[model samples]
Target chain A: MTFFEAENVSKNYAGHTALDHVSINVKEQSIFGLLGPNGAGKTTLIRIINQIIGPDTGELRIKGEKLNPDHIAQIGYLPEERGLYKKMKVGEQAMYLARLKGLSKQDAYSRLKKWFEKFEIENWWGKKVEELSKGMAQKVQFIVTVVHEPSLLIFDEPFSGFDPINAELLKQEILKLKDKGATIIFSTHNMSSVEELCDNIALIDKAKVILDGEMQSIKQEYKSNAYELKVRDLQKDINEILPSSFNLKKIRALNNCQSFVVELPGNVTSNELLSQVMPHAQVSSFEEILPTMNEIFIRKVTEAGRSK
Target chain B: MNKIFTILRREYLSRVKKKSFIIMTVLGPILMAALFVVPVYLANVSDREMKVAVLDETGLFYDAFHNSDKVEYENIYMDYATARDQFEELDYDALLHIPESALNNPNSVKLLSTSNIGLNMISDMESVIQKKLEAHRLSLSGIDKKVLEDIEVDVTINTFIYKEGEEKQNYSEISYALGLISGLLIYIFIFLYGAQVMRGVIEEKTSRIVEVIVSSVKPFQLMMGKIVGIALVGLTQFVLWVILTGLIVFTFQTINPDLFKYKSPEQQMIENKGLTPDELAVQQENLELSNDKANSLLEGIRQIQFGNILIMFLFYFIGGYLLYASLFAAIGSAVDNETDTQQFMLPVTIPLILAIISMQVVLNNPDGPVAFWMSIIPFTSPIIMMARIPFNPPVAYWEIGLSLAMLVAGFVFTTWLAARIYRTGILMYGKKASFRELFKWIRF
Candidate 1:
């Protein structure tokens, strides 16, 4: 079920179009990756979802209800340029943000305590945000974004300033949030994390969604018909055994096995290719190679730019 | 509404808890109270008695000096050279010598002192000598002094304002002071609190917390929350200043009861005569209606409608603050930092500055064209109207009503325009804001 929906949302700033007829549906209990390049309207779309700025045309709904002020309490957003009041104490700032999200003081305090303890920064509560390291402040920001237990959480460039270990920790916490039934809209230029964490995505380029849908399905759709095969022993030449239609793209010799990649024809199937190669060589392992989200993103964005 | 409250509470508490806020709150009262107490203390400190010795070679001005509370006179039966030689031993503040030709040349009399003698003492001696010389000349002409005194005429003009077919005493000077003071106070408050609002906005914007904040609340709510929050701070500071200043003045009055007394010049002169009660009554009778002018001035103060002035003062202060604070917030949002606000600050501040600069003109002629138009223009009305309100022929009710209505309308219009710019500007980063860009933001 769609937990949040922005339908045909168009936003124009002065003379420039920021978001043009953009639509995004965030499913319940899933991570929706909003991938785009600089000035591609990703932040604008995220802002619309957060209701920070309204779409000039179109409507937004949360849980089948039209988005309104009350919905503000249900949505928590961490923008790319997010920051705490630098002079405010970490714990106090967290409580403030949580209360702003409609949490009671007692609830905010307790939840903040739990989050601080979990992040192992309980001692830094009295410290001002300016006193915190970039990674630490990011952690605090993430905690505040989710402290209210918002059903829909949006984080833009969440892992930009985080080290690898902390990024991993954040990824786990994000997965845990989804497990707890919170839908997240993650906007970033980081494609690797998208592949690892996102279940659904919309690739927006030039104020339009060039690609979107289930992450697995997009990868599946964009995948060229190619497979990597590992042979322990080859009795015949690969080109001689395979049909002319099968194009061998690359080959590498290993210590105990020969690995080669082949592109299948439109009429051919991986299983058929495996069957045809089985008699000719010892096929130890065979698997299809899928396109990474990074490649798909670049190819789609470049194509959109060219088409425009 | 709750969200706005949340934001307001944060904005207020964050600032109110700052060291600077605490410092200003405590220091502002001291500075204001000094304005009330320092002058009174200085005047009392300078009221010391001085003694003068007169050496008259002409022997025509004996017993002519009158001694009051501040100055004492002693006549020395000796030549000017001897008096001048004995001046330090005599311990007189000054030696006043009258030459033989003093009757012909008034400037022939000289005063010699080891230290600087006050101008008051010099003037007193000159007046006493001149009166004695005039009497001497009059006696030579065989004219009676009492007859001459009886013939002296003192004319006084009392301005009466005919309002609503009724005569009312008008104290133009008092009204001018009241109007100027109140107008100046409003001007200060608007600028002081308006800049605070701007700084608060810039802090939020530069720290990049505005986006997070606006995401939770509407930009309008955030802007208003800040404006209202800082206004509360201003009000709190103002109330503390009033109370503290009142306490200081009250304490001073209790400590020195005579310091606050309104002693008229006639009363002081009568007391200086050292006459018995009967003689004082006769002197007061001879003083004529000139003494009534002083009493009537005191009465004019009591007759002034202070309650009306106070109510209007509050209305204008709050109205003016709201009108300007919203614009300050808009400018703050448009800029990246305080330095970047220079371009936008000039336009927003011009009308307020104009109102302040035009206040002098308004006070000079409260009923003139400049006052009338300025009091009606919403941008200038808060100050101009305040200046006109305290005048004798009071500002017309319709004019005040129209000005207030325009002020309210102007506040609404500026707030609308500011909100549009603020909502867009808060989210826009990196680029410096210009007037054209701000106008574009309003359209957005």
Candidate 2:
């Protein structure tokens, strides 16, 4: 089910379009990635979802209800530019933000305590935000964003300032949140994290979505007919054994095996290529090579740029 | 409403808990009390004694100079060079050199001092010489100096203000002081509290906390909460200052009862010393005169309608602060930093500064056209009306009512515009917003 949706949303700032006819749906209890280069309207769309800015023309619905101020309580937003009152104590600032997100004072305190303990930052409660390291402050902000347990959580570049260890911790926490039936809208340029965590994605470029679908299906849709085969046969004439539809791109010899990259013509299946290569050499392993999300992102953005 | 309260609570608590706020709150009343009491206390504390050597070449005035606690006079007959030498050797504060020609031209009488002599000392010396000269001239003309001295007259004017059906006493001096004070207080409170609202906005924007808070609460709610919260802070500080200053003043008054007395300390000292019957009678008459002055001052204070003034004061105080604070908040929202605020701040502050500048005119002629128009205009009424209130100006009820209504309308309009600018500006980064951009945000 669609947990949140922005339909044909358009936003203009002083005659400049920030979001132009942009549309995306985030599924329930899943990690939805909002992928875009800088100024690709990703932040604008996220802000629209948070209702920080209203769309000039569009409909925004949360859980099948028209978006209103009432929905603010159900949405958690950690903006791209992370901010906390530097003079405020970490625990107090977190609790204040949690209360602002509609948590009772007692509830905010208890939840924040649990999160602080979970993150092993129980001692930082009394420390001011400015006294904390940037990564520690980011941890505090992350806790503040989720302490209220909003059903739909939006994180814009959530891992930008985190060390690798904390990034792993945050990734685990995000998955934990999704496991607890929370729908997450994760926006970032970090493709590795997207590939590791996101179930669906919408790649926006220049105020428009150029590619969007289930992460697996989008990767599948972008795959060229290519295969990586490991065969222990330098003795065989590999080119003569290969079918006319298969083009051998590169062959490398390992210590015990020869690795070959083969591209098949359209309408040709990997199984047929594997069968054609099986007779002349000992086929030890065979695997399909799909493009990485990074490559796909670059290609899609460049293609959209060219078309523009 | 609950969200607004939440924001207000945070704004208030965070600020009230600040070290700077606490320091200012504690120091403000002490400073105000000092401003009122210190000058009076210092005036009552007598200055150090000064010794003067008078070279009287005209021996006729030798006995005219007498000794007092603050000044001692010694008659010395010597040449100018010898007197100057003796003056330095004796460490005298000054030498009063009366040349032989001084009997013809009094201006030739020169006073030489090692340092800058007090004006009071110079004036006293002049008066003594003038009195003795006058006596000498009168005697030479064969007239009795005592008779001329005794022929003294005192004139007092009893003013009664005639109103609709009754006549009441009027004290212009006391009323003028009250008007000036109340008007000045309003001006100070507005500037103090309005700047607080602006600073609060800039702090939130610069710290980048506005975006996070506004995501949960409307920008309008945030701005209103901040303005009202800082207003409460201002009112709290003002009340504390009033109470503290009153206590300090009362303590000082109790400790030195003569500090605020009408008579100078020298006169009070003379009355305390042994005196002949004639001198005693003169002291008694002076005391009676001071008693009458004190009574009249008390009566003037009693005639003021403090209850009405208090009510109107609070009304205008809040109305004026709200009107100006909204504009200040708008200026704050339209700028990226305090430096950028100057361009917008000038326009908002001009009217308030104008109100203060025009306060004297309002006080001098509370019923004149300038005062009437200034008190009726919403921008200037808060100060001018308070000033005119003490004068019992014939301001119609409808004029005050309309002025207040217009102030309320102005507040609403400015707050709406401020909210529009604030919502757009808080999230905006890097760009220095100009007037044109602010107008566009209002349209947005």
Best by lDDT: 1
C-alpha RMSD over true interface residues, model 1: 1.1
What DockQ does every candidate get? 0.65, 0.62
Native-referenced Cα lDDT, model 2: 0.85
Output the worst ten-in-a-row residue range by lDDT, candidate 1 chain B: B260-269
Q: How many angstroms is residue A38 displaced in model 1 relative to the true structure, after the best TM-score fit?
A: 0.8
Report, for every candidate in turn, its global Cα lDDT versus the true structure.
Answer: 0.87, 0.85
Chain B TM, cand. 1? 0.89
Query: Model 2: per-residue lDDT, tens digit, B1-444?
Result: 888888888888888898988898889888988998988776666678988889888777777776767788887778988878777787888889888888778888889888988888789899989988888778888988657856865667868878887888778888789889899999998988898889888888887778778778888888999888888887777777778888988998898888877654336545454455775676577667767877998898998888888788889989899988988888787777888888888888788789889888878888889888888778888999998888753467887898889888878887888888888888887778888999999998
> For candidate 1, lDDT tens digit of each residue in B132-238?
89988898899976678778877768889987799988898899999998898998999999999999888888888888888887889899989988888888777
What docking grade applies to model 2?
Answer: medium
TM-scores for candidates 1 onward, in order:
0.87, 0.88
Docking class of 1: medium
